[model samples]
Target: MHETNVGQPESNDDSDGIDQAWLQRRTAAAPLILGVVAIVTSVLMLGMLFGALGMRAGIDLWRAGNRRWSVILGVALSFVGVVVSVMCAVLWGSVLASVLLSRDVLRETERWRGQRVAAVECSMLSADGVRVSSLHPAPPMDRLVIVFVSSGIDACGQALQDLAAVAPDHPTCSVLLVDRDNSAATTRAFALLHGADFPVLASETLLPEPLGSVAALPTLVVLNRDGVVECAVVGAHPRSELHTILSGAQPVVATEPKETQGP
Candidate 1:
């Protein structure tokens, strides 16, 4: 009878050992499995959904004190998932904004094309209210190119350069750079850097009500010989398009030397 009782204790010890082994296996695999799931979901662009699951698994493994490397990898994958999700969101937002802006610009262009626009009899003023006629020509040109710009914007400077290059091509088209907000010094600096041949004017208000309000910087407006608005582009346009528009108008053969030139 004593021998039988000792044998029973041995069998119970074996059962306990088996149970412990099973528990350890489960604990070791948990974080690894969860980490793989998180990584896959992140690659699929699921954002934070599976990331939370992986993070929870990693935390659980850390508490269990098993599979340290698995926990580390799982946490790292979860972090990557979160970052990818954020980047995807920003990319989507930019795409949506671009689509909407394009639609609005197309509609505006169609509405203003071929319509007669009133001449803006506005005078250009210096920062100190000094009248600058060179920046604002005294009418009589075949076509007028008015570009509204804000200082320190690279896109605006590029637009100015493009217009300046093409302005000389079409003698009839006079290019004017209108400053939205900037000191005379800043404007001069930009003009110098870009080698602008057109006049730079400082104005608080947008000229010619027909062109509507200046909602965006670097708005380009083309006026015909009769003071009619030919086109108004809200953003920077390709040089080819600008040239096409200028080419449609009659070129003035003579060059009038009244205003600003490249320094």
Candidate 2:
């Protein structure tokens, strides 16, 4: 048998070198383009100011002159300069605003992508005040779970109503009600109204930090079994979006990553 190298490419060094060179060139060019823009904006503003000054001087000179042509020229130049200066200032302001907005958008994107949260260890307390943490380090699966945290009477009552309305059809689906109040009255009400099926967790802690800010009075977080946040909403949602999220089809609004910027 002839000696041969199996699955060997002839040469990648040349192509690799080309790719590196191209990347370097592109990186270098980006700053140069920004610098050029700044310089151009500055030059245009200066030009506009000078034009206005020349126009004013011409007007003065023409007024002092015995001839009509000198006066006309000076007045025309002054008008031209003023108009150009206004346009330049407006354009510069607009460009500056856009640059700032883009930077903000990019920073937000990087913040979300860079942030990683550890998987959650879920615990639940029944209306009877029983604690259940039996499953520590629960296997991170792909199923969807909604956490409804309530503080006041209205929220707790509403959650019970909603869960009762939604849970039977979603047996695999878990609804964790984190009640901070934990009052006997609240506990009794919870058990009587909504405690028959899904698990309920009570907490003295006010809120879940990792979820960040919420918009509406009632908040809903749809998390994957892995504990990574899949979708989140602050207020009530349309029946359609809610159903889709429960079905693992649509992502919650807050989970949609914000716009990003490029260097």
Candidate 3:
């Protein structure tokens, strides 16, 4: 009877060991899933915060109506929220993804940080035809891509269509198109035709000679984010070429001097 009791204790010990091993495996996997959830939640929260701020600013702008100063202040504050929102999203996602996936978050963070964008102002016929200049003081050493098209060139209609297709895939890049003529009706029509998500400026003023020399119609130029002209293509280009340009590598087209373009 005493021998039988001793064997029972050994059997119980083995059962406990098995249970512990099972729990250990579960413990290891839980963090990866939990970490992902935490990271996603953090990003979503930030997005909500920025989205709310933008809405508030928009409302305030509407209330102020033609009050230029009030509208300007509201717009400025809204931009602040946008910057913060983006930082939070990237940081949160990178940290969590790194921890869960056991990868370097720094590389991911840098990938996002490398992106630089310029909002080109297009005024076709107006005295204030040059709005792209306002985005200066941009990140140092950024490439400048220019779209110089006139109404005669289907600048708005086709340009917007091309942009909408490309923008989502290349979130790290900036795109600006200057309409050779500032035709409000044409601009509106272009917007209606191609659900353009980026800025499309209309100007009546002809693009300067140097810019005209680089790009003619349905043209795309890939510039280094430093505001230097990297490569200029006279006409439409393929997706692969654009991707190459975004990576700071020259596309397999014309290598141009920076002197022809502005940052």
Candidate 4:
């Protein structure tokens, strides 16, 4: 009769411990589950509203050292969603407006190129106070390739090195580098790093009409012997394309060896 068998204290403790473990597991999985939901929502919304949030969550998860590949894939998907959303907005808003906007952009680009070409035709004072036409003095070659560079830009340095590498192969083409900042120390360092043979010019006021007003670095300008800007490229060009530009502008010089007769 009397007292019922006392429940085992150890069993109660074990049950309590199992419950705590289950709770901890659920708590740990909550953030991951929320992240997945956010990513799915972002995709459904075309990334217009929740795309950035989802991307941030993915990045945070990666930083937290959890599911690296999943986070990367999620980040990529979020980026695509954002881009798609933007494209959709642009396309759906007004097709005519988009076309007109693109046309205006192209026109502006062409206008800038024209200004640069015109600037190349103008005269500029060199570092030595010598009045030089275009960016640099016209080289004693059939064609001239002027590479605009800056002190801190990596692309400019790469373009300079590319030109230097191809300089020997193209005898008729001369490669000249113009430092936009006019930093003598940087110019010297660049020359030393790349090669001493590549000529470097330091002029602050060079191309005052175009380059002086704007900060467009790493431009490649190809000119004919007549000092006319044949092709004015606004960014770094491929080595093959650079070669093509030079080769296309190569002047056909006809020379006949004079015959000498000795008596």
Candidate 5:
């Protein structure tokens, strides 16, 4: 047989020039390869990272000699990737914040139950700037609903919205907004903003026993004529659910706050 160079390709030089050939091939393909990677990653939400890689490779390739379509394509991919990455970042950030809020609301709700003890008549400063010292009304209303809230909390905000709708419909029931952060002025503003016409009360200390442990906002404690807790729940409730809880004509499961409107 004629001289046979077993596995080596005829076009590839011997070891002396192999490195140079390998480097040339690698340099030529890098921009196109990275550009494809960046484009693919853009669809998978990893555009920003791969985009940077493609940009460097494209710049290096352009500096070598000519501006090929591959070089332009590489640069274009970087621009598109950067834009896509920024938009996705904003959208995902908003979604993450909302989920975190809901998670906090659910955490507080899942652990607590309704209290049947005396409604702790802690001292409070009313929204009108008058000092009051009771969880109950002067005449002792037929029913009482005390809502605990903190400033800038979404669950509390949502609960207040529900209260605005149901509080007025049931005049016999007394409703009060208890401020957890001692933000009397802010709470008053919140009450007005959410349309909760009920009394907004704030205290500098933790509310008394059975309630002193309350560390979460948007906690609703319902009491009977005797000023004893009949139902206590955490988290935001819907208008209809609030109405039912206040009415008591129907059985109200108030140990844990529920998503009354969602499927």
Candidate 6:
């Protein structure tokens, strides 16, 4: 008589041989499927979902000492897939935000081009010793540039530092840092840290409209001597561009919400 039962078949999971349960459930192929699926989903920019599942599967396979070339490939590809997914997600999100903002809120903001914004009180700035101007110190300024900033956004903070860097190439315009979302003490410290010679304004109570209601960060509101807005630029601009914009006649065209590319 010929015997059918002989030896245990090889298993990628177990170093010695396949287990009894492994015979019932095809657990060996599960990791490979998950890892491959994760990669596919990541490519679709749904990496947050399948990428995680694939990564977990990969980790399990690695920990179990799966030495098969297919499983190893799955493990490696899963990691790569996760990274691609994250990068794609961020890129897509930024593009969407920029497009939507340009269509909606930014379009509405454009309407305020010729409207005169009120001069904010000097009490908005955290000055301990120096006498504060009752209103914006606009009497001596030919142009007033109101820069709305947020403490949360790194670009806004960098905008303050950039303004400081360009302080040497001073403009006839006076730059005012209006805190859209910032604490008085932190705003004061932030300005001082960046060596901002210009006026930095914040209020414990919400300031008036346009200034208080502004949604975009690092937005520059350029005004003439009459407090009427000549132009408004929304984006993170470098010191050189900022100097030119501040020093020039008027900025009618606004830059797209993205990192400025230098000529």
Q: Considering every candidate listed, which one attains the maximal TM-score?
A: 1
lDDT score of residue 253 within candidate 4: 32
Give the number of the best model, judged by lDDT.
5
Mark the regions of model 2 whose C-alpha exceeds 4 Å error after superposition. 1-116, 120-122, 127-129, 134-144, 151-156, 181-188, 191-197, 205-208, 212-216, 251-263
When 3 and 4 are scored with TM-score, the better candidate is 4
- Can you give the lDDT of residue 150 in candidate 2? 51
Poorly placed runs, candidate 4 (over 4 Å): 1-35, 40-139, 208-215, 249-263
Clashes of 5: 0
- Cα RMSD (Å) per model? 9.6, 25.1, 23.7, 15.7, 8.1, 10.3
Q: Model-by-model lDDT, in order?
A: 0.66, 0.50, 0.48, 0.58, 0.69, 0.66
**How many steric overlaps are in each model, in order?**
0, 2, 27, 0, 0, 0
What's model 3's TM-score? Answer: 0.38
lDDT string, candidate 2, 1-263, tens digits: 87777788656664676796675454434333333333344437664555555555544444544234434544454455556657778988999997787566444433332122444444555544565442212444344444454545565456555555665665555665544446434554554564434455545423344544332335565555444555555444554555665666643323433468998
* Cα displacement (Å) at residue 32, model 3: 87
**Tens digits of per-residue lDDT for model 4, 103-196:** 6644433333323233354333333443445543355676667667776677777777777776777887766667767664567577557653
Model 4: which residue pairs collide? none
Which candidate model has the greater TM-score, 2 or 5?
Answer: 5
Candidate with the larger TM-score of 3 and 6: 6
Report the lDDT tens digits of candidate 3 across residue range 9-106.
55545667678667545443332333333334444555345444444544544564433443444444444545555787788888887566433332
lDDT of 4 at 220: 69
Instruction: Give the lowest summed-lDDT range of ten residues in model 3.
Output: 105-114
Candidate 6 — which pairs collide?
A: none
Q: What residue runs in model 5 are displaced by over 4 Å at the alpha carbon? A: 1-43, 48-53, 69-73, 79-101, 117-119, 125-131, 136-142, 150-162, 209-219, 224-236, 249-263
- How should the candidates be ordered by TM-score, best one leading? 1, 5, 6, 4, 2, 3
How much RMSD separates candidate 5 from the native structure?
8.1
Model 4: per-residue Cα lDDT at residue 138: 53
